[model samples]
Target: MTLEAWAVAAVLYVFRTLVDDDIPLNAGCLEPLRIIVPEGSMLRPRYPAAVVAGNVETSQAITDALYGALGVMAASQGTMNNFTFGNARHQYYETIAGGSGAGVLRFGERGEALEGHDGADVVQTHMTNSRLTDPEVLEWRFPVLVESFEIRAGSGGAGRWRGGNGGRRRIRFLEPMTASIVSNRRRIAPHGLAGGAAGACGRNYVERANGERVELKPCDTVEMQPGDVFVIETPGGGGYGAP
Candidate 1:
């Protein structure tokens, strides 16, 4: 249902420029569109089917799919980069930002001047525009240290309109707890359009106190002893046009 809502909005966004009539939030806009979801499908699973990931990761995938098919833009980072850590007394959840696909406009079109447009870095695209907790606030509340948070430059696809770059975040644990990563676009790269290049895939891992690094799967839950560092490299958005 959420995917359908986002898809509808995306379609409207691209078409609004060609039409003169206003498409109001009410029936005037929504009535023309119909959404269907099989009750048993993943989009609409059975009761208590554990579809929490659907809200975060799967939702973005659906939007990415829409973006590709509609030719509005390239794919954005397909994951929310959500992570959670908690002990008996405290729980913390944060969603990291990523790159956004470059703008979509044909040459000589109304927006032709933006042919060299590039995707925005460290953005929250398609899904909820969630803002991460301030590093100072996070460190003050949790037994964790914000080691680094920076842009993963060049991670985006190359094109006339280059794809956006993803981000990197590393957090060091100061105490023992359990941590989990829920994300996607690790295997499949975000696709490009109009002969553009595909975005780079994301990566995740843990660095133990001994400095040994262990790669994390798309979804993993692991124990984190004191001094362990968790690093998430979010996926980059796809390019919109050929370089």
Candidate 2:
């Protein structure tokens, strides 16, 4: 769904002079997204599917595709999409995010955030721009508890123009259940532009609901039991200029 949206938007932007009025596109213009669910899949519901998982995953894909098509920027850290569900009164939750790429502009250039914070723009390519869901909604719909959610500090790459920061998500399960996550930017650092610095990588940790200690990677899908906790450290954007 996201890809189609972007494709259509791209066509419009390129042919604006001929089709629509030639309007200078400013930052924060959300790229359109489109999706087609295969028959008999989770998305192929009689009515509307939950859409939370689809939103998260599709967002990542759209971001990646945008980068690939535009070719004006470098590769991003990766996608940060997660999913969690509970059944039989059991609860499970997972949260994750991706990293940003190096600035591809001039040596002393700055990235466009489109929206959000400043610094390196949070390029949402074909593989990004997803949604896990709302904590309140998840807790009411599922059997999980959202411990905390915020942007991880000092995670962005260091440079003259620092990279954008990723996010952090924490979830605690009340009963034994299952959880899963799909993310990247661990192996491939976000590409940089000119002399810009690369962005930070992503990380994942497992803290027991009882406060135990356990660490994991950005990409992993596992089963969770009662009193289990999960923490997701999203990737950051790259620097645009030299420090």
Candidate 3:
């Protein structure tokens, strides 16, 4: 199992423990629990095989399962966890970042999709509410550089209850750097509720620091060298409640 799945499992155990005794007090607390996994998922690993999409896909499946079990809200826009690794001080340094899902409360009585998706927490579960201030730290430590990093203006889906904003991050490298992405919601738009619209899609791009560029899809893992930059646009949150 990947670290993300393991973390979820740990949280589940803790949540059960905390509410086991108090469950009878609140009927709402007695929802059933289930785990969702795509067939042949990495989470279903056997020592012999590995699935590259396991990390991000599994996390998303689990999140959807949580929402369904609770009978509380629609699925989240989706999760994004793009990773980058490079050599720094003769050692390897890595970083993972992504966007957040829409909130259930935002949807009115009739659930709807969000116009713009919001960013999510990092792997550590910190909500993607803010921005990363500097790429200099990563550059100083690793064989990478920051080309451009900013929020994608007007990328948010418009609706009665607008969706959250996703971010755009660009990274350049002095040497070849490895990248792995765990992102979704490109095919399925961020759902809305109570007369709202779906959110915009997430994307990744690889381009030269100077002129040419290439766009990468979700779950794309590649290598980059000097003068090449990787741009990651995070997903946004779904809109809530009708305007």
* Candidate number of the best lDDT: 1
Candidate 2 regions off by >4 Å?
Answer: 1-71, 88-127
- For each candidate, what is the lDDT? 0.81, 0.55, 0.52
Per-residue lDDT of candidate 1, residues 1-243 (tens digit): 454454455545444543566655543554555666677676656766765666678777777776677676788898898889999987999888888887654446553434446888989886658899999999999999999999999999888788999999999999999999998999999998778898899999999999899999989998999999999999898987768
Q: Estimate each model's TM-score.
A: 0.85, 0.59, 0.63
Consecutive 10-residue window with the lowest summed lDDT within model 3: 121-130
Task: Let me know the TM-score candidate 3 reaches against the reference structure.
Answer: 0.63
Error of 3 at 41 (Å): 8.8
Query: What is candidate 3's lDDT per residue for 1-243, written digit by digit as tens?
Result: 664464355336434644536544332443465546454554556556755544445555555445434433334445644454544434442333433333443334554442333323222122222334456676676666676666555444444435555667777777766666657765666555445445566777788766877777776777777778777776554444454
lDDT tens digits, residue span 59-147, model 2: 44344335534533434555645555566665544444544654333222354432222243333444344556677888787766788
Best by TM-score: 1
Q: Number of clashing residue pairs in every model?
A: 0, 35, 29
